[model samples]
Target chain A: MITVDATGLSCPEPVMLAKKAAKDNPADEIQVLVDNATARDNIVRMSRGVSRTASVQESGGVYTITLARP
Target chain B: MESVTKERVILIVCGIAFAVVAIALAAMGNPKNMAICIACFIRDTAGSMQLHTAAPVQYFRPEIVGIILGALLMALGTKEFKASAGSSPFTRFVLGFCVMVGCLVFLGCPLRMVLRMSAGDLNAWVALIGFAAGIFTGVMFLKGGFSLGKAAPTRTMTEGFVFPVVALVLFILSLVTTLFVASAEGPGSMHAPVIVSLIGGLVFGALAQRARLCFAGGLRDTFLIRDASGLITVGILFVGMLIYNLVTGGFNVGFAEQPIAHSEALWNILGMYVVGFGATLMGGCPLRQLVLAGQGSGDSAISIIGLLVGAAFAHNFGLASSAAGTTPNGQIACIACIIVLFAIALLNLRKQSA
Candidate 1:
């Protein structure tokens, strides 16, 4: 598993980081941490491009997005 | 801690600066409630380039070029420029085209939507609701499996620099060529001086670049996360323009007889719906596309090309609306665009989990 803490980063940046992580770690589940809904939503969207599923969990103002192939 | 404070200050400053400069430009004769409309300005630029012969709206807006150049300068200075492209370029083009159709039909982009509301054009409120509805719908798609594939890094940094170079070339071309013509009358003929427009564009571009300002993103965040960090700019922007209009005696409140706007309530709502929806699919607003181009995204450059082409098609085919009202063809086109966007959404989705 690869983890990325993308808290405080804005839209395209979070999306880009998620894309990079997904590309680098194919076959492994990639996890992303984001603070805002926009980042969480966008990262979820980007994950669909690289993987089959992205399950998200939110806790105390932070979202954890895990990307995995079906 | 210091960086966070600095970012907050910059955001507030940039937001205020954008509002003040836009209203000031409008007062100085750019257009009422249209100090900086990416779609209209781009359409005007197309006319200036003689891509379309719509006599009422033709002029090479320096602000458009200035935006790219300004962003380029910031990116270069900060060494944050990364040239990337090749993520569903044609779909982006189609989205850009449809967005222009919607904006021209509504007579404004997202920026002008806010400015018009600030200027007391009540029609903008309807468009706002429609925009919000469209965004809500698009967010539903995001929650589904819709995706536009990832943009890979370009082989060379020079590939990213192409957009800036294109901006420079356009600037030079505007200076030398009568190929680019100014309008003799109508919205096309009315404009602030070229130098002022350029300066305004540069300031807005630079500030928006640093602040990462996006009108659509603001609304999206508000709806999705219940966060208002982006929406804060929207509020500040409205407040700034409200003060500017009141002070300059430009505040006119009414639905009918607003300058350069149509009162066809349904079309106005539907037109902006297309803009809000298409912008969401493209991952940013029209202004955001220009900024991304400056930052060396070839995909954005392609999307900008799509915008220019869309503008040409809109004017040439009578798909754009006017002060009188939306044309029958324009109305049909707006509805068709919404359906097409839905189709795009459905077509791009991954299959459901079994």
Candidate 2:
């Protein structure tokens, strides 16, 4: 599992960071942390582009989204 | 399916309404060649502030303010207000700036391009072609995996209301500040009254939001994915505007002496080429960007900032052309913008080993 910290980042950055991290570790489960809904939605959309299933869990204004190869 | 159908209807209705009001405005002395041009108006507004002292193109436009306030009211009513910012704020700003530079060179936004052509300004033909080519280039980048990252959702009330608030402030300032001067003549002087223009803007904003109308997106979808929903809206707008111009005796086919336009064919096309490509890459047209900002898209707000600064630069340095012809510095600015844009594209590309 590879964890990418994207807390406090805005829209495209979280998705861009997650995408880059995923590209670097093809088979690893990538966990992204985001702070906002739009970023989460965008990451979900980007994950679909790469054939990854993304699941989200939110706690205390922090969102943890895990994406893995499907 | 029902929702999608309703969306399409909204889009078409908005397009037609925009055409009707735009044509009516033209007849009312707004300008024959340009009924609604956000970029041109901004440039003119910049001049009004004596930002560049470009005479004959200085006027305070109420339509811009109307676009924001109208959209704000609709969003508030519809419960779609949300404000948030993320993504590379500076990068979006640069893209906005480039978009303005390119649009000014072409002398209109994508919306105005169609209106100009439909009015028989032959120069618009070149612009349209160039715009398509630009969109094609952006499509290439998309195919190659160009992305601007994502936007995280935020507090619906707080995030969404920020831009509208700013717009409201600007509208209020527009009324009180004699600092922002209006043009005595030229395209800037040609305007409909505040009430009519504001209502027109409100109608446009409501319909556009409901329909997802975007000029560059319309062309991009057509070329890349063979999608026609957006493109159809453009078609309706052109046809509607054409008929209205004819009925009102506003049609003067041939391009010369066209309001807010120039006859430089090559530049007209290439300018929009840059604009179309840049706007597509950014994921929306200028008007769409404005609407997005009103709806609390932080990235879009950054883009708007870029647009205003770019307008300042265009007029200050003489990059923007006028009714007379293309300025000498205009060509230089266009070439420079293209070179810089390509550089950004190259840098943003993912490197691959051969």
Candidate 3:
């Protein structure tokens, strides 16, 4: 599992970070931590582009997005 | 399915409102092909404050005040009002400043660019290409992990309320023409009534806040991740304008004799390129910045200040293009801002996770 803590980052940044991680480790499941709904939705949307399934968990205001290869 | 339908409905209503308001305001004398330009209005606002002594564009615009206040009202009503601020302050200021410079070089913001196209200004179509190129470049940077960090929550609500309060003051001052300097001619002098501007701005602000509309966001999302959903509003807006113009006999074809626009293709392209590039880095366009400020973003408020000062600086330094054509100074500034923006983008890229 590869973890990217993007809790303080915004959209396109978090989306891009998670995407780069997935690209670098194609066999690994990538998890991205974010802080807002916009970032969460955007990251999920970006994941869809790469044919990855995104599952999200919410704790307080932080979102942990797990992107798994199909 | 119900929620998705609701979202689409909201987007449609917002798009229709923008088109109708834009045309109505134009008819009411808000300048041809420029019913609601945040960049232009704010530049004129700066001139009204004597930020720059540009005589032709000097006037305090009430629409700006309405937009800010209207956004504030909706935000507060929705319980989303925040003291959300403290991002990369200076960087955003510079970016905002650069965005204004870019917009002026092209003679309009994304909204006015669409409006200009609707009015059959071919220059706007050329500018659209440049804006896309710039957005494409920014998307490449995003794919490489480009970011300006994040905004921290403000310590006090007072910081957030400042923008709205100041806007209220400006709006009040706008009613008394003697208190503020206004142009007797030029675009500044041509305006809808003070009440019309305020009410129009308020409606626009509330709708924009609700819709979360950002022209740059639409283009950026489309370029970056192939998400075209953000573009529903823009598509609707353009179609509405085209239909309205055709029916009302407002359509005038060709680049020459276009109102408040120039025919210099290269500069028009380069200018909007700067706007698209800078706004993408900043996460929104000039209009979005104003709405963000009204929603209590100190960072956006600073960006607004940057826009105000930048607009003034453009006029003072002759970096602004006019209907006559792109001036030499405007040309130099366009090239310079592009170089500066690229350097900023390169310096801010982070490849590491977290």
Candidate 4:
């Protein structure tokens, strides 16, 4: 699993970083942590390319999206 | 805050925040429908800085400073303050400049376009149509692999703090020279009290920063993903504003005699087309640009500077339109901006596809 803490980053940046991470480690389940909904939406959109399902977990205002490939 | 889901709740909050802020600003003495206009405020700020000699719209707007401050404070507190730049800064600048020019030609940015429509300005309908069409065109380019490249993180965090610091300096300067530099006449002369305006700006800056509220982004999202969450926020704001206008007697239907607006329908449409296209290419609207700058994007800062410079150029070079009608120079400038933006889109988008 690869964790990318994108907490506090704005839109496109979070997605961009997550895309880079997903591309770099294609086999691993990438867990992206973000604090805002817009970033969450964008990250989910980007992750849809490589993964069919995204498991989401929330705690203390942070969103953790786990993208697992089929 | 934790209860905010990625769906409708965030959109509702953003909608309510924008609506409440717009109404409050209007009640406190901004122009009738234009409680907070990014492009207009930037133009006024430029005039106040003597970047342009447009006397009527010259005033150092506290809202402009407050938006950056609010965003910076939030970003820093959240530990998300990453200073970054170098994503085709010059191209972003040109896009920003073109966006401002288009807004000037139409006398409003995307935010103002919505606000104007909410206030029952029928002409805004034309502008809105033009905006959507322009976005449609940009989306076609995106389908062809349009991109501005990714921004790299800067070496120091201090780079991200620069814009907020500059805002603070500007606010202090406005305070000391209140009587001298502040506009004594024109639209710039009419303003909400400094404290109220600053507070209004702060609230909006914080909310928008948090929610990533952007008009252009909303439209873009609607086009790209069948998701209407952001567009719903905009719609809710329109409803909120409409209710407020109705309650406060601010609602007046028909286009003629609207304050600080023109009746030249074609120019208004073409002008906003330019704004919509430029903003699409830049990846955010004028308001979003301000928020991004606050969050430590140096590229956004350059774009903001471009907006200011573009405002200055609009007025100083007689490229800005007036309440009476569009100037020949303004029309010519709008055409030139469209051509330049198309050229940029073709050059960059083609390179990416290759």
TM-scores, each model vs. reference:
0.85, 0.81, 0.91, 0.88
Cα lDDT tens digits, model 3, B287-341, are: 8888888888888898888888889999999999999998899999999999988
For A16-52, candidate 3 gives per-residue lDDT tens digits of 6787788898999999998755577778767767889
B1-354 in candidate 1: lDDT tens per residue? 124366567778888999877976786779778888888899999999888889999999988988888877776775556677877889999999999999999999999999999889999988998898888777677656566765666778888888789788987888887668999999888888888999889888877777667888778756654445677667888999988888888789999989889988899999999999998888788998998898888888988998999899998999998998898889888999999899988887755332
Question: Candidate 1 — which residues are off by over 4 angstroms?
Answer: A1-70, B1-4, B351-354
TM-score of 1: 0.85
Q: Better model by TM-score, 2 or 3?
A: 3
Worst 10 residues of 3 chain B by lDDT: B1-10
Model 4: reference contacts kept, as a fraction: 0.05
Interface RMSD of 3: 2.2
Off by over 4 Å in 3: A1-4, A18-33, A40-70
Candidate 1: residue B257 Cα off by (Å): 1.0
After superposition, the stretches of candidate 2 with alpha carbons farther than 4 Å from their true spots are A1-70, B1-4, B154-159, B350-354
How much lDDT does candidate 3 score? 0.86
TM-score evaluated only on chain B, model 1: 0.96
Best by DockQ: 3
lDDT of 4 at B209: 78
- Return whichever of 1 and 3 wins on DockQ: 3
Could you give the candidate ranking by TM-score, starting with the highest? 3, 4, 1, 2
Against the reference, the lDDT scores of all candidates come to 0.82, 0.76, 0.86, 0.83
DockQ each candidate and list the results: 0.08, 0.09, 0.43, 0.17
